[model samples]
Target: MQNAITELEELTLNGASRSFLKETAKWCKFLSIMGFIFTGLMLVGSFFIGALYENLPQTQAMPFNVGGMMTGFYLVCGLIYIFPIYYLYQFSVKMKKALISKDNDVLAKAFEMLKSHYKFIGVFTIIILSIYILAAVVGIIGLVASS
Candidate 1:
């Protein structure tokens, strides 16, 4: 393990690797910017959801405030989306700076941000998959009970 760590520490980026990293940083910046814009749009759209749902006849018949619930849902989703996007944005900016200046600390920080971004996404994916599985099980149980 120590040998592996030493080897990793000694590893250096070649010109090709640096070029690829620079290109990746550029793409990350573009994607992060797009994500931020969409998240902002989603948050803005959340406000309109209440108004839209208020006009629906089905929602009107419901005892609960469907509009408010939907707006809150959208807002929560938008807020949840911001973290990974911000991490990605930070990774991109830091990576570009690190590459340009050949700063090891900055590069490490940039990679840390990238790791955080992926980790957040991975955990989120697992949670979503778990919810899907739970929903499927509940649906099957409901169908069986009805029959």
Candidate 2:
């Protein structure tokens, strides 16, 4: 176990790959910024939904306060999006620092953050797929009933 741990610690990016890592870090930073901006837009849109809902005429009110539901859903999605973006941003920053200083420890930590970013995205994707499958099943049942 100790030998395995030591061998893992020895794993490092080749010097030739430094440029590639730098470019990847740059792209990650850009994408992270865009993600944060989109999350902010989503958060703002959630409030906009609530405001729109409040202004709707009583006659237009949806069957289960769907407007409020939309707002809540948007807010939750924005909040959930924050975690992956933050992890990616941290990875970008740490990766840059690691490359600059040639610090293996920082590089490892950056990779850990990258792993966390992917883990969050993977789990979210699974959840979304499940939702899609459920919706499809429900739609099929509705179609069968209508027939």
**Root-mean-square deviation (CA) per prediction:** 2.2, 3.0
User: Compared with the true structure, what per-residue lDDT tens digits does model 2 show for residues 42-100?
Assistant: 99999899878777778754668767888999999999999999999999999999999
Q: How far does residue 19 in candidate 1 sit from its true spot (Å)?
A: 0.6
Cα-based lDDT for every prediction: 0.96, 0.92
Question: Which residue runs of candidate 1 sit more than 4 Å off their true CA positions?
Answer: 1-5
**lDDT winner:** 1
Model 1 global lDDT (CA atoms, 0 to 1): 0.96
**Top-scoring candidate (TM-score):** 1
Alpha carbon deviation, residue 111, candidate 2 (Å): 0.7
TM-score per candidate: 0.93, 0.85
TM-score of 2: 0.85
The RMSD (Cα, Å) of candidate 1 is: 2.2
